[model samples]
Target: MKKRLIYGWLLAGVTFASSCTKNFDEVNTDPYKATSENFNPNFLMSQAQIQFSQTGYDQLLFQSMWVQSLASTFDYYANGDKYVLRGSGTGYYSRTWNRGYGALTLVDEMKNLVQGKTQYSNLDACGTILRVMFIQRITDLHGDVPYSQEGQAKSGNVAPVFDKQQDIYKAMLSQLDAATAALDLNKDKPSSDLFYGGDISKWKRLGYSLMLKAAMRLTKVDAATAKTYAEKAYAAGTMTSVADNAKVLTDNANGNSNSNSDALLVADDFREVRWGKTLIDIMKTSNDPRISAVAEVSAGTGKAANEDRATPGVNTASLQIGMPNGYDLNGGATDISKAPNYPGTSPANPAVPNDAPAPVGKYSRPRLTVYDDRSGVNMLYTYGESELLLAEAAVRGWNTGSAATHYANALAADIRSLAQMNATPQAVVSDNDIASYVSRNPLNTANTTALQQINTEYYVVTSTTFNFNETFANWRRSGYPVLTPVTYPGQYITGSIPRRMPYPITLPQTNGANYQAAVANQGPDNFATRVWWDKQ
Candidate 1:
């Protein structure tokens, strides 16, 4: 976010006409300040938007610990008998401050590019959705972060005040709604989408789907608001099929669109995290394929067969265990080195075992989020997610559609989407392969069985790589798909699963007043303290 880089890039496309010479001997350039008159709106818009979109992509993966340890569907870290998050751990500085805020800076430029241009009104739709996604990410992670005044940092008020989380959600919903409504279907913009090949309909679906997700986030403290947004999004036609899912491509060119999945294995901090037992056992009990899909060939290992866990010890004193995510077992640990063996186990299919191992190289498979691969880059606000949300909404009697049909559709969509991801060469699954299993494993609700089925699958799909955010959030909301507790040292966090991520260490210097006020209003502001939406 240096002033020099922003200015230099801001003028990326505009050409300069060199003035003949101020003294008739030395060359002078037109310094009247460049205008947008000659700039190609399409080119400028693409670069700006693409750069901005990468913020979420980068933060979600870039050695993020809170998400991996605290929220992954298949992992857990315990604080004695209770569980808690260790968000205060050291690896998160870049995510907490840099990538997210940096992306906001670019979004500001994108918004300016399409602003009063008559011919490029459709481009506004594109900018609006991406910007809102960034803003929501900021609010979701930090809660009450600077929204309205962010990215305007250089304008004398480099530090902007914080906005309320509730108000931020409302504004973001408004922006998503407006932008989706404005997107022109016939107008061709750019297909260079690193996620979805410039598919406007898919983008719009994601807009509405994200609106549902935002609304769903408030179910604890504000059911009425949650239902309102869910209903509106449902009526607005959110994701109806797997094809509509949004994603981010990872070619790993500079590492392409990929991360150095290998780099983390060497870091003590990174390898300390491993899979939790709660989810591992469940996958085994139901005979779910995702178990092998996530953890390495743990079936015969001591942890897998005996304790039914793939325990990766965090031998380093610095790392914490039993994450707030809630998926650990009594005797085993998860392995980070697992990422290298997955769908990427062979040279043919290109599956990645994205998890990192300890310096000793002792580890197992990684529990990847939904967006673990390039194909997974699609931002998935899926029919599966929508159906599950609706089913839950219906279970609560929020009133949008039929809970039964929604439940069934949720399963079908997720199964289809999941199966599609394995379509790679060596890992392909035939259509006739799992049809029998799907029909039986998650039988439609006879009594409360349907609720369990819906929530369990729902948890899995919410994660781009695995069910990272959804697992914790859904478990907190409905108390479903019952999981067991993990065993770990308590000094890392308080006695139970900590809820909110600890405010970054830098908060004291940056947004002093708001940071202090949050701690005052909400005790300690650690993992134990819940966000506004986490009702209990």
Candidate 2:
């Protein structure tokens, strides 16, 4: 199955060509290899799911640190930690846009093959859900992106105009609703379904859950639409438990390793990236059980020990200190050593060549065994997210369920989701621990406080799962776990947390007219500018 999925990924990228000789048409076609006409469209859906969900450096360089879920003093991460453009920063700005559209193109091809075909009905619906989920991410990151005519370049419409974010949200909601309604359990299931093994019922839950998510994105900008769809999504049904989580298990044997793990394993990233103080402090303050599950302190002294991926770290919650953002090892005023409560540098080993005291070594990095697994699960969406969204909706007086019940459920689901990140189940938080934590931290009754608590937990859950894009988006929308903007020398933004990533640097040359128009309508294409739903 893994090999076949890998083949699908490879095949998705190829463009088939035919021989000019009319008499040799039959001979030209390879019987062993699959072509569009004879290929399984489900493979396209599988490829789309993997490509869209594997958000490697795309989110790592920005969203991860923007939300202060993970922090780094590494210069490469300065683009996010210090709000400054460093190495590959300019290129990173375009990753989400380019990769997202590329995946959407696969979905478009899949839809083209499967649409209106009875046997492919479920595949088409699943593809639509995948398409909307990804398009939402693209527009959320780079506001007013090409949507209406997206992926139509092969049809000679290469310069598709950027659609209004408002219209895009509406269309996404409508498509999600229709797709959820269209899923038929009796129809054929996609053979290469990465999420649920082509269970149409689960796909229906995911579609409606996505509807709930898309609806919630409109809460600040358009409350009426938000309420209507949130209610509809709830009524239609969302993920009922962790069993309904939408995730894909990576296959390292097939060269499809977890992208987050690959990025973290990079030597520079391995040594510097730590769970941020903002996130760890919140968990510690709340006595959140997940703190120990998600974080760990390096096992020994010196740079070599800290960067060693083979040795497991201690995950005692008390020892897990988070590194603050916007500090570096530049040996100056802004050095991490100068920060308050800075864990002193690890001892330098005389035996190790060129080994200096490992700066920021005492601070917590993501538990290597759990998070750095090449074949770890990539969480696309979770039952925790669905429940939390419902909890927020309930707080706003929408008919979802009891705010406390949903909040508690979400908390438990979030903790349980950690087990999925690791290969060994014994390394995860226990059910007793999860239950106790949920009991101790029931939803605060006051509406505003409740909102803060819910979204803050949402931030923790998504961040720990490495769903950094969603973490950043929800933080922007809910204004929870309020973060102070990092003030670093030579920063990019104007003394504020960035709200949106700028358009790809090449947009002016590739699609100048539409790019200019989008900038005009959506405000300047910069970090300070918010997307349509991110109303102040």
Residue-by-residue lDDT tens digits, candidate 1, 181-209: 88877887554454456777777787888
TM-score of 1: 0.72
RMSD of each candidate relative to the true structure: 10.6, 8.0
Q: List candidate 1 segments past 4 Å from native.
A: 1-27, 30-88, 91-97, 254-257, 260-274, 298-364, 367-380, 419-427, 441-451, 481-487, 521-523
Best by lDDT: 2
Rate residue 196 of model 2 by lDDT: 93
